[model samples]
Target chain A: MKLLESVGRIVAISRKEIRQLRRDRLTFGMVVAIPIVQLVLFGYAINEDVRHLRAAAVDYANTQNSRLLLADAHASQVIDLVRKASSAEELEEWLRRGEIRVGIVIPADYERRLEDRKRHGRSARPLAQILVDASDPATYGSVAGLLNLPPPERPGIQPPRWRYGSAISGVSNPPPTFEARPFYNPERRSAVHIVPGLVGVILTMTMVLFTSVAIVRERERGSLELLITTPMKPVELMVGKILPYVLIGLIQVGLVLGVGALIFRVPLRATPQDTIVAALVFITASLTLGLLISTIAKTQFQAFQLTFFSFLPQMLLSGFMFPFDAMPRPAQWIAELMPLTHFLRVIRGILLRGARVVEMRHEIWPLAVFALVMLTLAAGRFRKRLD
Target chain B: MSESAEQVIRSQGLTRRFGSLVAVDHVDLEVPKASVYGFLGPNGSGKTTTIRMLCGLLEPSEGKAQVLGLEVPKEAEGLRRRVGYMTQRFSLFEDLSVFENLDFLGEIHSLKASHRRSRIDTLLERYRLADRRKQRAGTLSGGQKQRLALAAAVLHEPELLFLDEPTSAVDPENRRDFWESIFQLADEGTTVLCSTHYMEEAERCHLLAILDHGKLVANGTPQQLMDDVDATVVEIQTEDPRRVREQLAGMTGLLSLAQLGNRLRLLLHREVENPVWQVEEELDIDAGATVQVVRPNLEDVFVVVTRDEVS
Candidate 1:
């Protein structure tokens, strides 16, 4: 009978929460909107594969060989030859003015330099040099790999030199110098990496922001005082408060992953069962975080500020915006403590790497532990009185 | 009604301190079962604090409380199901419909579905909220909201109800209606401990406890408090009432002086002899004032009690 009573109380609170959620149209919209809007924004707009950078050419050679090399540069689709500079200085001026991202300065002895490099093999001066702007991140997620187009292949000059890559610092090597072939997503599409990690971002943002205000709103409106005077247990209130949002969290997962597969063509490499399990663990962790925030914050506005404060670090360090391995060791340690960091790896591993849940167990355990600890803290912090 | 009737709530030297400020100083209580007991005090007089300690929502700093034969703050979980608390602020889920609010409480009290429905139906009818059952609680008028709050508080059929200023927002007509509902609950054997700053409301209680600076200065029926007052109740009527007010304003032998239209009612401290004659001599009115030694009521009782120092 006591167990039945507990179940009844939990159901009552969950039902009340659902009714309130439906009534609040603005908050209700966030559950569906956060996933779709963020997916389309990050998936389509934020890209790593850059193309057709505005470029200028300073062909001092002014010969058949230089013209053929310019044609090859345009053909690679990495640079568009917009302006023809009279000198290398003019090309440098265009690059600094931001009118152009890449500049091709073919030397005056282009043909002679090519033959000289062919004769000298590794020791000769390069025939061409491509200068690129590497200051901004948009430019930095770059044209580095694609700009290495071979300098106009010749028929008679057996294996001509003048490779002229980034290592044009006088030291030269044989052809095919350190080419990068992408694995998993060989096309290097941003959507493939972004669409999966978006599930974590949207869940973290909405779930934490949503539940953190759950108790605080009650406290503000005075309903929590009335609620505490009832027979409902503290743990029962905590569980019931999160139960409805948990369903919302699950529906969000289906919407995000399904839309990802349909629009972005992000592949589902692992079993759906594994993905669902990971999503449930992550959803619990995020909800517990929100519940804890609700207990700490005195008002709904504070909950919002705290939610955004937590979200920034996870978005930046969870291998979402930057590669996780590239961060400094101390930053990586901070990232490891965030539940999103572990969930990001587990979700990305399952979705992109085709790894099974067993293989990702090391990452998933942290998520479970985080949920348990936060749940305990939230339950402990929620008092039944105004004090 | 009998001498051997039980006490549903009892406390001895109940104290609550928040930092250095004692919100509820040492207070003793004996609330008879099935009585409409009133807590009378001004704002910050610790009526709410004392109620919270008895309801187990707050822990007493210096003493112990027993409600429904259960020790508070330790057996608070057990006490929760048996007691109903209506806070000063309207604490119902305002976004929820009136019926839904009662339904939620019914569930929390672990009522079976059929019993819950029947109990809710009875409360809606009793509180005259049957017509506005579908209205959101936030949109309800002040009186209608209080009615719904009372209905929700009693939905579980608790043996005790803690109402903290339940009628503050209510109109006189609705407040009268609210009292009728309280009396009905008392008839059904639900002991009510209601707190209020309004003297008119306090007078309606079957028994009363007047708090002053976190201490219980007086506890008894309204008549007992009036008869046991430590001052003389004198009413002075004159044409120039302001002159009378100024004359008796700072008299050491006066406990409290209040103006009711043209009459200056004073609770004169028993330190002086023939209080009524003394007030008549002080008036010195050109229109000639009449001094009548009248019977003291709850308002005079409140003034006399609140001015006393904590013992």
Candidate 2:
């Protein structure tokens, strides 16, 4: 009988909150519209695997071998040969002016070396050099690797091979070959990586901002007095006040995830149950944090300031826009304290790595513990008395 | 009502202090059932503070209070369902419609669905809000909002109702209508403890307590308070009442002087000997001027009680 009464009061409060939310058309629109707009805007704009970098080729060889090598580099699609330079100095000027990411130079004796190696077949070596702008790591890293791919196989041309001796003599020589094959996102689509992390960021922004003003608005408007005078307990009021916003948070998640899958073609690799559980835990943590903020704030304006104060730190330290491991040691420790850091890991792990729940224990348990701690603290901070 | 029944609310030296400021001092009250008890005071006189303590919305810094026979601060949760509180401000959910507001209150009070619906309908009709049931409380006029707040407060038919300055925003006509509704509830054996700064409203209550700077200076029936006033009231009608007021301003043994058109009402200290003669002598009586002693009203009692505390 006692439990039923508590349920009844919670339902009553939740019903009132839902009505209030409906009446506030702008807030309701923000919940659904902001996530979709942010998802589409951020998902399509960020690119990690930069391609089609401009290049200047100074081919002093003027030979078919140099032309065929340049054509092979061009066909790889990593660099676009925009201009031909007469000297290495001119190529260096183009690279300095940011006109091109790579520059290739061939000596005038390049064909003589190949022909001599073909004849002597023993001691001759071919020398070809490439100049590259190593400034932007993301842009230069991929382009430089593509520029160094194994020389194309030519008809009547034998590629160099190192001679190996018998094992009994303890002498061995092997050819040097470097190859890189990226997994998970073989194409390196930025949206596939960014969209999963966006689920956490969007949920944190909306859930914390929306729930932070719930109780403080009531207190400012005097409805809190009416609520306290009723048979509603503090815990019941807190739960009921946040339950409607939790549903709104779920709707936001669905909208963002649906848009992510349909528009960005980001895979949903995790099981539905795992995704739902992670989302629930994250949303609960955010809402409880907001409730705690409301209890500390005396007005709606203070609540807003407090929400933004926490929001900025979460956005910077949660590994959504920057890599967590790249930050300094102190910053990484601070990031560890943020629930969004763990939530981002769970979401990205599930969506990108196809991580099962058993494999995501580290992320899931911390998120659950964060939600539990925040809920207990919020309940403790919310007092029944007006004073 | 039986004479041996317990008082609906009883307090002994109930006090609340905020740092160095005392918002509600040692106030002892015994409010019996089925009576309209009015708390009259000026702004910041702790009327709202006392009401909050009674409603279990605040904790007193010192002393004890038993509301509806339950020890406050200890049994406040049990006392919640039995009491209804209407704050000085319009505290209803403004975004909700009239019917929705009342329905929410009924549900929070744990009323069954069938009972909630019927009670809400009756309240809407009684409060003359049936036509505006679909209107948002925020969009309602001041008088309409007050009626809606009252309807929400009484939706559960609580045994005790605390209205803190309930009609401060309404006009006189609406205030009269509101008092009529309050009286109707009292007639149905509900105990009412309301706070107001209006003297006429206090005059209508069965019992009145006057607070000044967190102290309960006076408590009694309106008639008893008037009879027990420590000053005598004298009305003087003259061709120029302002001149009479000016002349009486610096006079000794004078408590307060108020002018109503061409008549001047003076409250003199009780130790004065023949105030009419004293006033006439001081103002230089003329043949056309008339002076006579009259019965004291609640305002005179208020001025006399609070005037000394101000100094």
Candidate 3:
């Protein structure tokens, strides 16, 4: 009888929630609109198979070998040879102005350096340096991967040591050509990597944003006074309010995954059951996060600002934009605490690597724990008292 | 708080403080069952705060309350189903149709669908909203929205109802219509506690409590409060009412003064015998002004209690 009563009240609140959502045309529109817009924007915007980096060359060597190096750099279609700086200082000035990303500075004695390397089986320094702006670390990695192309057809001459250099972005020295093998996504289609990650990102943005504002919106509208005075328990209210959103989250998952496969041709390698379980776990975690925000925020606008601020760290550090392993230990530790970080792992595992939900326990358990912790905190913060 | 079968709401030394500011201070109340008890005070007089405490929407910083025979803020869950609250604003979902709003409330109360339908029908007819059952509450006019809010509050058949400034935004005609429904509910043996700043609305209640700056200064029936008021009423008619008002503005024992057209109505301490003569002496008019003692109204009661700060 007690279980029946709880069910009845939860169902009632869910029904009311759906009715209100239906009446709000703009919010209803957003449930479908957010995913598609995020897909298109994120698909092309964060594409990491970067090409045509605007480049300037400083040829201190001014020799045939230097010209051959410049031609190869341009012909590689990795960096656009846009300008020829008369000096390295001018090249650095161009980089500072943000006009160029890759500055190929061939040292003054490029041929002699190669000859010296062959003669002594060692060189004093690298033959030349490719100065890249590492301000956005995600994009600059592709510039280092330019060595994937065949070196500029130098006959019997050993490969030139074109060292990857950094400028103006805070990194004194960045690693060279990280993760260029392209295992799961063999076509190296950025869509393959991004679509899976987009599932977590878009869900996090919509789910948390919508649920976080739920309670605060009711309080602002004064309906919360009536709601709390009802026999509705805090747990019942929380469960009921999230039901419709959970369903919406499911629809969004289907829409995003379906469109991703159909339009982007990004294959879904996970079994149906694995996909459902992982998505549901992630959806709950994200919704719980939103509820937590909703309880903490005093106004709808404040909730929105908080949601946007919350998205920033997750987007930058969650391995959705940058490589997870590449981030420093402190950043990785902070990312470990976010449910999105684990969710990105689980989703990418299921969607790209064909891992079962249970096999992804390393990632899934944290999300389940996250949902529990967030639900507890949100319920605790949602006191029945108005003040 | 003393427990009595006749009292539906009882509170002793009720207080609420917001940070360093005391919003409600040491209010003691006994609300008899099935009575239309009113709280009459100006804005920020702790009227809403007291109602919130009783309804379990706010916790009292001090004191105890027993509402619907349950200890409030402790057994507030028990009190919730037994009581109903209609906030000062129209708190029902504006995007919902009238029927949907009531249906949602009925479902939340765990009412059976058949019974929920019948209760909603009766309320729709009683509140004159039968034709508006399909209209979204946000689209309703001021009067219609007020009726819908009242109907939603009562649909679960609560034993007690609390209305916080329910009619502040309504016109006089709609306010009268709204009160008719309140009386009907009271006749059905449901207790009601209402707060209002309007004098006429306060006068219509069976009993009234006047709160000034979080303190209850008076409690009794309207007639009893007037009969037992500490001040006496005096009215003066003159050619230059402003001049008379200025002359008597700072008179000792002068509780309140108002110009009703060409007449300056005043309240003074009952100890001021022959107040008409005192006011006339202040005006110093031979035949330009006429003054006399008068009966006290609810507004006079309000002025006597709250305007003490000015003196």
Candidate 4:
């Protein structure tokens, strides 16, 4: 009976807390506005896949074969023929300046060498070099794959070799040429992985940070003393305090999901309802954790410090950026413990793979566990009397 | 001090300690039912700590306490339902309006919605806060906030009320108004235990306990305490009271000498020796000084009880 009374009292206090929060404009914006803004920006604007790799060609050979190869290079999807550099020096300049990612150099003796190789049955190959810029390793991977092709034809007699370099060798050496396929990011763009991760980070950081500071700030200002002296219990106080932030978190999820669909063309891998449920679970856990931290912290500054430390490990361990499958067994196990890690999977899965709620159960358990532990610890820490 | 069956509060050897500091020493206290009992003390005298123990908000480190006829700390939860506590600091939600603060407090006590409105209305009218019903608690002045805090504390109509310096920062007029409301509660047969430093307010109390340095030095009605320390407090009007104070420094059993405006009031241990004559004769100070004995007030009694001067 007493516990019921305590719980009832806490609820009343929590309602009062929400009323106070609504009155403060800055706090309202931080809790409600920022989450939605972050969601949209992350979901729509950050593309990770590579679309245009700048390429140039120097057609010195001028044979029909050379023209055919040039036509093939032009027709290829990976490379964009942005400029025609007539000489090696111009090609080198373009590569250095980063105007083109891939540059082609066709040798001057290309037609003569091909006719000679056909008559004598001994080939002297014309030198064709593919020079690629190696910055941004992901975009350069596709640009580098273009070199695995047949070697240029040679003259009938041993051709005069120049100090320019050894003529391209291994011609007609019959092995399948490299056929590149990207994993996780087939388009090889930056935004696909980044936007989802950004949404998680922003929601976690802002929601937890703000909610953690709320109670501690009241305590510092002498209002907590006033609150505890009344009939309110701790649980009601926590729930009432977290409700607004949870709503804001939902709004943020919607923005990020919408932007990902409309702008980045990032698809929803699951039903909207499933995504909403997962988001609600994730937000509840986050709010619970924040309230728990607030109970232990004496001041707003301490709350922030606790929140910062809490999020640092999650950011590093959650496989938002790095692949968890490749990590060590223990590290991967730890990653599964983080609520964000599970939610990130659920969010990306639904948006990317159209996974159902049943398929996302693995993610749901961690959030549920997180909520239970946090709520219990926070309730245990809050005392009714002033010390 | 032990009381009869009707006593609402009783304590024996009640004490509380924080680190090396003894905030409340072993002391016995008894408060009769339906009476206004004032715990009078200076700052750091442990009035707050004692009240917390009585309200079941704190466990006394050593001792036994009974509040509202239930053993404290052990029966704190049960006693909590019967007592309303208003702390020194105003604890209502700042963003919430006066009505909301009262409503929230009422809800915490699980008052039925049907009964809540009438109780709130009574409290609002009683505190004269009905006109400012919609104003946020934080926006109210210090006195108004204190009034609101008191109103909220009493919303459930607990049998006993504990007020810890509830009007410390309030203006004089508000303080007077607060005391009137307190007296009204006492008339309604509710026991009230309040802590305060204002001696004038102490005079208005039916009973007072004067605590100093964590020990109860004097406990009785204001008149009884004054009568116990029967002494003459003479106010002497002079141009140079400090000079007069120096002249009368160690002469015969003079208890205390304090300068008031343009006069030095000499609190004599007794008028039997006629020391005033000796002082007037010694300095030829009869012309400028006004020498007349007056009845000792509570201020004088306070000095006599607490002051430990050598001479």
Better structure of 1 and 4 per TM-score: 1
- Give the Cα lDDT of each candidate: 0.83, 0.82, 0.83, 0.73
Over the stretch A259-297, how does candidate 1's per-residue lDDT look in tens digits? 999998888887989988999999999999999999999
lDDT of 4 at B101: 82
Task: Please report the candidate that would top TM-score against the real structure.
Answer: 2
Writing each residue's lDDT as its tens digit, candidate 1 over B1-311 gives: 55434889888889999999998888889998999999999899899989888888887889998888889978988988789999899999889999999999899889999999999998898888899989999999999999999888888888999999999999999999899989989999999999998888899999999988888888999889889888889888888889878877767687777889998888887777887768767766564789889899888888777776632
Segments in model 3 whose C-alpha atoms lie over 4 Å from true places: A45-182, B1-3, B250-252, B285-287, B309-311
Candidate 1 chain A least-lDDT 10 residues? A174-183
DockQ of each: 0.63, 0.74, 0.62, 0.39
The TM-scores, one per candidate, come to 0.82, 0.82, 0.81, 0.77
Candidate 4 lDDT by residue in tens digits, B1-311: 54577788889999988889989998689888888998888899889999888876677889999887789777665765578889887777778899998888788778877799999998888888999899998899998898898898888888899999988989999999999999999999999989999999998888889887778878898889887775667777777777777777866767788887987777776654675665575444444776766667888887877774212
lDDT of 4: 0.73
Whichever of 3 and 4 has more DockQ, that candidate is 3
For model 3, the local distance difference test gives: 0.83
Q: What is the lDDT for A129 in model 3?
A: 76
Q: Give the per-residue lDDT digits (tens) of candidate 3, residues A1-387.
A: 768878999998888889888878999999999999989987764534556778888888887767887787788777889998998888765654445666877778777765543344322345677776543344456676774333243545534343211211343332221113222455556677788888999889989988888767888899988999998888898889899999998899899999999988988888888888988999999999899998888899999999999999999999788766456679989999898899887777667656567667878899999999998888888889898
Candidate 1: residue pairs that collide: none
Estimate the TM-score for candidate 3: 0.81
Instruction: Rank by DockQ, highest first.
Output: 2, 1, 3, 4
Task: Give the Å shift of residue A361 in candidate 3.
Answer: 1.3
Per-residue lDDT of candidate 3, residues B19-98 (tens digit): 99898999999999889999999999999999999988889999999998899899998887789899998888998899
Instruction: Write down the DockQ of candidate 1.
Output: 0.63
